[model samples]
Target: MRVLMVSWEFPPVVVGGLGRHVHALSRELAAAGHDVVVLSRAPAGTDADTHPSSDGTVDGVRVLRVAEDPPHLEFGTDMVAWTLAMGHGLLRHALTSLLPGWRPDVVHAHDWLVAHPAIALADVLGVPLVATLHATEAGRHSGWLPGPLNRQVHSTEWWLAQRADEVITCSSAMRAEVSALHDLDAGAIHVVHNGIDLRRWRSRATAPAPAGTGPRLVYFGRLEYEKGVQDLIAALPRIRRRHPGTRLLVAGTGTQQEMLGTRVAEHRVRRSVEFLGHLPDAELTALLRAADAVVLPSRYEPFGIVALEAAAVGATLVASTAGGLGEVVRDGETGLGFEPGDVPGIADAVDRALSDPRAARRRARAARARLRTDFAWPTIAARTAEIYAAARPGPPQNLPRPKIPTGNLFDRTP
Candidate 1:
């Protein structure tokens, strides 16, 4: 099968887990002898004409990175305009470079960022469209479309879900969220969990800590509010009182970094918490392996890929039973679990891990073992292929553009 995957982020241009997900899936599909091509954006400041857009073949998968159109639009301030420009560039590239020579059996879109181009390409090619909703705007805001921008994003997500021939989500929780938010039949949404590559994340031997060193807890991901990092900070003081010499190492960057730092100072646990900012993969893997416990305190995780990373490195996990984290970490069987935003719960879970070194190691070993059967990339890719095979092609037809409702119904009256 020939597959064309549309994603905003890929490989060296990764912004988050979505890029890693697409990279791994595309490689696995290509390795299985399916022709896979990924359409992604080039890195910032690349000369569009000079830099070769097509990276011939990467791990058996062809990658076409398109440059953003010449515009002074900044994504931070003008997201909708920036996205529209990106979509225009992608559509133009597809029409000129791909159509005459190669065509895809199905067009797979990763998220809302590339929705416009994906929808347009699928319609033009007359192929089945497959969309994966990594996370919903409503879910991020805890089910409230508070502002105009939020409503716009939610409407786009609804349109994408409605237009796709089949929809895929990373977790059962996300499937339900997408169905409810978009008013789509729950049966139309498929749950395909994210996967990990064990080869790259194997456990490494770490040098032993000095006799008086504290227990190191590591949190390596974005520091956004929804990630519950501040809650982890709030729990630190309580954790230290129970077990002195319990220090936390935070390694990530986000808009909430400054606010989290302020909270750390307010809690008076400043000395115990060290902000390491963003560390590269090598440093991060070493940190995860050496840590006493790797904490993931997400409040709205679609699927916690970081849990798999921690498991692969044989690190004991202390995670919140929120969204997909509940599915990944089996309470006592895999690692300790806590409720999201529960400061006491976080402290208690960490205390349990520290109190029993043997039990923590045992659970960590179980988590590592489960990876071979449950979170393997090949198994995930095969399941995804089934979805593709089941997708039926249909003729392209015009669908009404999604409308965002203003508070006043008569605002548009002349």
Candidate 2:
């Protein structure tokens, strides 16, 4: 099977997990003897004025990165405009011409942002369109104010989900959320948990950090609203008191940087909390190797890949029990689980990592071993391919697309 995947982002130009997720999934599919082509927008090419194919291979997957102008709209954030313009650039060549040439058997889109383009591709190519809704607006903006942009995104997502032959979600939690939000039957949605790459996250049982020093507790990801890093920061004052030297490494960049930095300053634990902004994979692996535990304070995560990566890297894992994280982290086993807003509980989980060194190491080792066997790219991609083969052509009829100006949308379908 040939799969053309449309997504807004792809590494090393990733803003979040979606790009890496698509990258891994596509690679897996390619390894399984499927021809997979991933279309994305990024700015790394010799030709500045043209869309660069990037004509390279990643774990058997072929990636063609299209170059486009900065997606800066007047009324919306870059995120909003990028979503729509990501698709707009693809139509430089007519969809009618592009689809037949690519000759894809399946048009698989990664999220709502790419729905329009994917639907358009599937329609033009006469192939099955499989829409994967990694996260929904309701889940993303549950506690925050959802603007017109979010509503428009959901409307387009609803249309694609209903029209596509199948909708792939990250977990049962997400499946339920999507079903309710789109008013679709739960059975129509398939739950495929995100997988981690063990090769990149491995720690060869390295030597520990200074003994008796407060253990290193790390959190790596975007400092976005849904990440709940603020909650973890709030719990830090308590964690610091129990273990004076316990270090907290917050890796990743976002709008929340100033607020989180101020949090450390206010708590007078500026020394304790190290804001290691946007670390490279080498740095991430080193930190995971040194850390006693990794914490994910996501308020809304479809699947916490960072927690999985931490486990794969031999870092004891603890994450909020919100959303699909429960499916990945087993309490008192592979990794610990805490309630979303429970600051005390968050502190307690971190304290447990600091106090029980041997047990934590054992759990980390176990989780790392599990990830090696279970989360390989080829395995995950093969399953994705199965979903594509089983899917039929066309989205279900009568699905509604909420209105948002195309100016702010990522038009997945040209």
Candidate 3:
């Protein structure tokens, strides 16, 4: 099967797990004798005027990276306009370069960011449109469209879900969330968990960091409110009380870094915590292998790909029972679990892991064993291919395009 994947992020331009997910899936699909092409944006800071777009091949998969339109639009300030510009660039590139001689049997969209271009391309090609809802806007806000931006994003997600021939989610929890938020039938959504490439995440030959006086815990991911990193900071004092000299290493960056720093000061655990912003894969894997426990305190995770990465490196996990984390980290079986935003619960789980190091290693080993069968990229790719085969391609429907409302009011009409 020929597959065309439309994603806003790809390798070297990844914001989060969505890029990694698409990258791995595309490579695996290509390996399985499928012609795969990814339409994504070029790396940040590329001059769009000089290099409008470029094509390259990575790991046997063809990639077409488009540059943002040369406009005075900023993503942080004008998200909707920036996205529309991106869509326009992608659509123009596809019609002119990609679709003349070559066409895909199906078009797969990664998230709402690429919804416009994906929908337009699929409609023009008369191919099946498969959309993967990595995470929903409503889920991130705890089911409330609080602002105009949030409402607009929600409407775009709903439009994509309604227009898709098949809807794929990373976890069963996300499937239910997308269905409820978009008013789609639960039976129509497919739960396809994010996959990991164990080879890439394998621990290096270098010796792990020497054990310190106290337990060393690591939390790697975006430093956002929804990631619940603040809760992890809140639990630091309690964790230190039980296990003195305990240190927390925070990896990754986001909008909440300054606020998390304030919380660390308020807790007076500044000395015990270190913020290591965005380590490369090699450095991060070494850090995870060295840690006593990897803590994931997510409040609204669609799928915890970090958990899979930590497991691959044989690091014991201490995660919250939030969304996909609960499904990924089984208490006592895979690793330890706590309720979302439960500072005390997080402290307790960490203390337990630190107290019983042998047991934690045993569970870490179990998690590593589970990855080969459960989260393997080839298996995930095969399942996704089945969904593609099941999708029926026909004439495009005259569906309403999602309109980004300028004001508070939204057009709720179907």
Candidate 4:
């Protein structure tokens, strides 16, 4: 089977988990004896050097990165236009042809960023379009579109749902949310949880951080408001009271760094809290292996890939019981959970993880086993291929692309 995956983010140009998800999935599919081609964007200012096939081979997956002008025009006004430009590049290649005259059996797209071009390109190629909604615009903004940009994005997501032959989401929670938000049948959505590369993490875990007397807690992901890193910070004081000399490591960079840094200063926990901005792969794996517990305090996570990674690296997981995270972290079983903004609850869970290493290790063991059996990429890729097989391809033609509603306008779908 030849699969063409279209996404805006990919390795070395990732904004979040979407790129990693696509990379891992494509690699697994290629390993399973399938021809996998990824159509993605090249980083800014490198268009001259980048080629459609310049990315070379990433674990057997062929990448065709298009070098387009950076979409930095006037507060995201040109985002949709830029996406169309990317789609046009993809469509041109599909028509003129990939190397060796290879064409796609199916077109799989991730998120709304590439939806416009992906749907159009799939139609042109007369191939089945498999749309994976990693997260929805409405879901990200807490059930409201807020402004024009949000509304446009939400509309595109809804349009993708109606346009694609099959829609795949990361979790049951996300499936239900998309269904309710877009007024679509729940049965139309397929729930496929994101996966991690187990061997890679395990190899990087060869040298865990040296053992220290203090309990080391780490949180590595985007430090945004919705991610709830501040909530984890709020819990630190109580956590320290119970377990003296406890230290926290906050990794990743985001808009919330300044605020979080300020909050840390105000709380005067500067010495204990270290903000290591965006760790490299080897360093991240070591940190995860060394940490006593990993905290994921996300207020809105469609699916927590970090949780799966942390669990795979043998870190005791402590996460928020919200969104798809609840499905990932089974309370007192695979890992511990706390309410979205419950500082005290987070503190208690962290204390339990630090205080009882035996039980935490048991849970970590359970999580690692689950990662191998349930969340493995080969299995996930196979399941995704099944969806692609089920979808019937059709020629490119004009379809109903209703104007997406905007600004808290619910209970209506055009």
Q: Tell me the TM-score of each prediction against the true structure.
A: 0.94, 0.88, 0.94, 0.91
Model 4 per-residue lDDT tens digits across residues 1-414: 989899988988888999999999999999999999998877644543453335467889988777664444322456666667666666555455463477789999898888877887787678899999998877776667778777777878888887788899999888888887766788988999899887777555453454357888899999888899888888888898999888889989998899999888877788889888988788898888888889999988899989998987788999998789999999989999999889899998898888888998999999889988779888899999899889897656565655655555433422
- The global C-alpha lDDT for each of the candidates, from Candidate 1 onward, is 0.87, 0.75, 0.88, 0.83
Pick the lDDT winner: 3
Candidate 1 has an lDDT of 0.87
Model 2 lDDT on a 0 to 1 scale: 0.75
Provide the lDDT at 396 for model 4. 60
Model 2 segments more than 4 A misplaced = 44-57, 69-82, 94-100, 143-145, 202-212, 395-414
- The Cα RMSD of model 4 versus the native structure comes to 3.1
Decreasing lDDT order of the candidates:
3, 1, 4, 2
- Clashing residue pairs in candidate 1 are none
lDDT for position 22 in model 4: 95
In candidate 1, where is summed lDDT lowest over 10 consecutive residues?
405-414
lDDT of 2 at 242: 85
Per-residue lDDT of 1-414 in model 1, one digit per residue for the tens?
A: 999999999988888999999999999999898999998887654546655567467899998888766677777899898888888888888889877899999999999989999999998888999999999887786666679888888888888898899999999888877776777888879999999998887546453462347788899899888899999999998888888888889999999999998999999988888888887677778889989999998888999999999999999999998888899999999999998889899999999999999999999999999999888999999999999999986666566766654443223322
